[model samples]
Target: LGMRPPTPAHPTPQYKGRARDFLYAGAEAGVMVLNAGADVMRFAPSLVVEEADIHEGMQRFAQAVGKVVA
Candidate 1:
């Protein structure tokens, strides 16, 4: 049984509006996230999610980040 480590908590406090950027980008990429602060994006997933769902979500989220930082 092999499993990857959990994603570390990423709290953005110095970059202004970064969380907001992620929020919009994630939405466009089919991922949902919340801006919990000026630069913090809150992430929450369904309790009854499957492994495949998690992978797909991460892929979409990565796409969103690419859009925001590119």
Candidate 2:
């Protein structure tokens, strides 16, 4: 969460490059979808995904973005 602050996918006046990169990283990790536009991230976990799985998924999500932002 502290890795990088979230920003708008479609900034009103201008689009930001870093925000778009963050969205792409999240999607590549299979952790969540950047659906709700570039500014929002959505986690669509199935009911079958256990609590442990959720935790692991989040960890993976963080790792994926960490590489990009770090």
Candidate 3:
């Protein structure tokens, strides 16, 4: 994946952050996020996925970010 912020792909190495930590936290929160390559987090929801599902997934993602991010 190309440069993506909050996924260890930032232009600044010091602010690149950590994708592993986010992935781990997401897993613990029962949220599944895939890596397109090494940095981009791919969140491909199913066609049957509803609005509420997206909302909930985002909430979980936010929580995971909070866990690993400052």
Clashes of each: 0, 0, 0
lDDT of 2 by residue, 1-70 (tens): 1233332234233433455665677778876645555544556566565779878877887787687756
* Residue 16 in model 3: lDDT: 49
- In candidate 1, what are the lDDT values of residues 32-66, reduced to their tens digit? 77676666666677666687987898899988887
Best by TM-score: 1
Global Cα lDDT for candidate 1: 0.71
**Residue-level lDDT for 34 in candidate 1:** 69
lDDT of 3: 0.65
| Model 1 segments more than 4 A misplaced | 1-15
lDDT of 2 at 24: 76
Which ten-residue region of model 2 has the weakest summed lDDT? 1-10
Error of 2 at 60 (Å): 0.2
Better of 1 and 2 by TM-score: 1
Model 2 Cα RMSD, 1 decimal: 7.9
Displacement of residue 61 (Cα, Å) in model 1 is: 0.5
Cα lDDT of candidate 2 equals 0.60
